[model samples]
Target: MKAGGGDGGSSVSDEEWERFLRASLEGVPDAPEEPSARDRAAAARRPPERAADTAWRAYTPPRRRSRKGWYVAGFVASVALLAVAFAPGGVTGLFGDDARGADAAPLAPESVAPTAPPDAGPEAVRPTLAEPFKGSPAARWADGPAGITVPEARATGWMDRAEVARALRLSRDFLVASNLEPGVLRGERPAGAIALINPRQRDVQDYLAAAFRSPGEANDPVLLFSRFDPAQARLVGDVVKTRGRLTYAEGEKGAVRVTADVTFVYPIAPAGGGDAVVRTIVRREVVMSWDDPAKVITEPGTFSLVSYRADMTNAGCGPATGRLIPSFGGGGGGTASGPAVDPYDRSTSMDERMGAAGDEECGTATRS
Candidate 1:
């Protein structure tokens, strides 16, 4: 964050220089005669002088020169001191000090790149179809469902290794269906994913259906599935950058639970088409559990979706949470109301945020 040009050299006015000279010589005695080799020897031979003696008394004062002559010599000495102080490898040069006397070499102006102010967010860069994810962390992420990786399955306390593997696979299918499927991303009902949920969870099924039929804050389909209004924006390319992992563990009542935590990056351009592209981030975490199919009234491939959470960043805030609405360059209207959150930040668990029931606010984003 170094900034701005050097301050340039300093200058001393006649009045100021004179004042400096007077102050420096305040208690200094008149110039003493240079001791000859014999006189120096005699002085060296003498006993040690008192440490408390005034500095001016250290020198044997001789007959003082005329006032004008003394002033001329003192001025010349002061000028030499100034020359050394400003020279390369001198006080100013050694410290990278920018200030110097006017005649000193001008400091090479620092080639500092301009930076945004602390309160200001990253500069907005228009995205192109060739580089839809430019200027974003998503650029390095895996494209599409390839980024959603399932961890190595291991037997939980209640389920065998084979059952745990099935649970992991089921969770992965649900994620791909809900977030990355071409039909689902186009605002179509996520039939494949919905079907995967346990048929016995009637309440969950009803809620999912109502979210799409009658959209509102309580049941926003966009929170679960990534979709954009076809009339507003089109996919920039076929790829959607993504990254996350799925883990399996034992859940209540001897069931194996697979949790998927992932972030999806979607790049879109205006539906009419052009080079402008914008990215919308969707982070979803879903928990799916498997039990004895005979005991839980479950099918072979389906699992009970115990719980889930999702957060959409760069998606504008308002009553339009039903579907993702990508804000194009300088387009879309909505005011953010809280602290900016970095969607790429996966260091902390999303569970902490989603669990806080009262913490939802339409804030800003550090970047798209």
Candidate 2:
């Protein structure tokens, strides 16, 4: 990226100009005498020399005073042309250069309405909602009072740092202020607030980086291509209820992880329902790796490469074998393999216990 004003035009200085002039003229020869004043062939002079003189004599000479006046007139005309060409507006009587348009107005400090950039990538042009969904795909369990029927995900992993702590702090402040986290996830509702977030692993900073983010768009440091709304939330709910799986499992090692599969569903609603129902079967898993990964690897992200399959704490791994029997191939595609149900305290809330794992990096929060 070009950091400062372009072309170094602002860096020019008077001393530098003087140095440039000196270097340029260092070897230039002295001005030669004007040929017209050298010899006159008329009268006392040899009559204007040869046959070539025909063309020379055709060029008439003016009186000395007139010559001086002619020189002054030419100089004035040159200066006028230079002034017009280099004017503030850079005009040619009736036309302006492209630069003039750029310089015509003072830029606003707030923000300029961005013109479409020539090099924006795919999501740059995507239409996004003003609001976004909160709560993880697996959080859909809160949807069913019958109990979270979502498939039990075998997850394992450990945190290198305590990012979940920071996110919780911010979430606490936000919940206190708004009374409702924009993605209002009322777990078994009409009671207290747990502030579950929407799908974040899907809505990435740059999909390649796997940057972790909060569920709410309002708390985001910078805006994404777009936000989510109630309609989108209802859509998310449908997708989760139908075709989703949330794998949240903890190993004997203190490591913890969770994962889920999700789809984008839109325009879905319940029968005569005011608040839309979340309905979709998204397959998700969480993986937590230990300080020493040699122990376990079966949590959602434990695979590290293709999948995560372990969360190893200083304690040890559960499942005895530490084997993440592949449920599906190619990462949640092809077949739906049943997970080995060693729940190992499966009937509990993943967040309330070890808290959501950090799927992101450290210290680069954007300032809105």
Candidate 3:
């Protein structure tokens, strides 16, 4: 379906957001710069690199946005950068770099990553300060549930306006409770989110319950909830930057289908206090449907899961232990191998990245 944004993301149109993300993907420097004393210290505390350590360094966040004032100002800088970088003349001309004859639409960054990365520590950038996202694109993202904006409610097919509105509200609530709730993020069972699922879907209910109760390689909880190992790491700041849109359509059996594709950026630091902060990017696309109570005879405020898919960047390829294992420096986690794809690049749809069913593979990401 052709998805459109609601008033929630009115600050920037969908086309603008897409353009911003696509342009930001360009200009990534290749070589790792000299590490600051703080980064050197953080790297020293990390465990020795494993064969998969290349995966961790690949998840490093984008170049930090220099902040001159409050968070609002930081966001403005990102927008300004997007504007000039994609101006009529390419960024090379603006920066007095090599001239590009006539087609000057801002050439891609010179130092892009190779198809596969080498075994090395991540490039050092700015240090994590009181404001964790000060130097990242996430600085502009809305905090937590606020980013999951619901579209205007309207009747669709057999569903009434009220029903459509309720379906949207229920879907938004479930997304927030499942991914943003503080307890859920800390490895706790997503009880609030589960309570909103249609009990009639016994298989889905059972699967979710078992996933959290006995998490393993096959039934990992991180697929649905963004949980972290408390003993290993804690949130660097209270904010979790989020951006996405929700849309609804008519479904079979007098039902309304709601689709949400949202991207959440989390900044985490090592347990206790640590100098390094890393961002884990998760893009989740969930399809839920609510049938007319008269015809379906299901519980109120509950929806059936039509389909759910996700693509996580910078977080390891698998939830081996059932939680998002963010590699602070060069730590080990689930195995990852594949061509390097930029997590921030949103030019492609989620379906394109996830591919057809049963095509599961541990792919590598370009950056956090």
Q: Global lDDT of each model?
A: 0.52, 0.19, 0.54
Instruction: List the candidates ranked by TM-score, beginning with the highest.
Output: 3, 1, 2
Which one is best on TM-score? 3
TM-score against truth, every candidate: 0.63, 0.19, 0.65
lDDT of 3 by residue, 1-368 (tens): 01121212124443453454445323223322211111101111111222433433534333211000000000001112211111111011111112111121322221221233222334433326355654344555566666666788999956789878878877878788777776656765565676666654534544554454455545566666777777677766566767677888887656798878777877777776657767777878787777666655345677766666667765565334667767776333445443345554444455455544444555555455
lDDT top scorer: 3
Question: Which 10 residues in a row give candidate 2 its minimum summed lDDT?
Answer: 65-74
Instruction: Give the candidates in order of lDDT, highest first.
Output: 3, 1, 2
Between candidates 1 and 3, which one is better according to lDDT?
3
TM-score of 2: 0.19
Q: By TM-score, how accurate is candidate 1?
A: 0.63
Poorly placed runs, candidate 3 (over 4 Å): 1-124, 330-332
Q: Which candidate do you rate higher for TM-score, 1 or 2?
A: 1
Name the regions of candidate 1 deviating beyond 4 angstroms.
1-125, 330-332, 352-355
Error of 3 at 356 (Å): 2.9
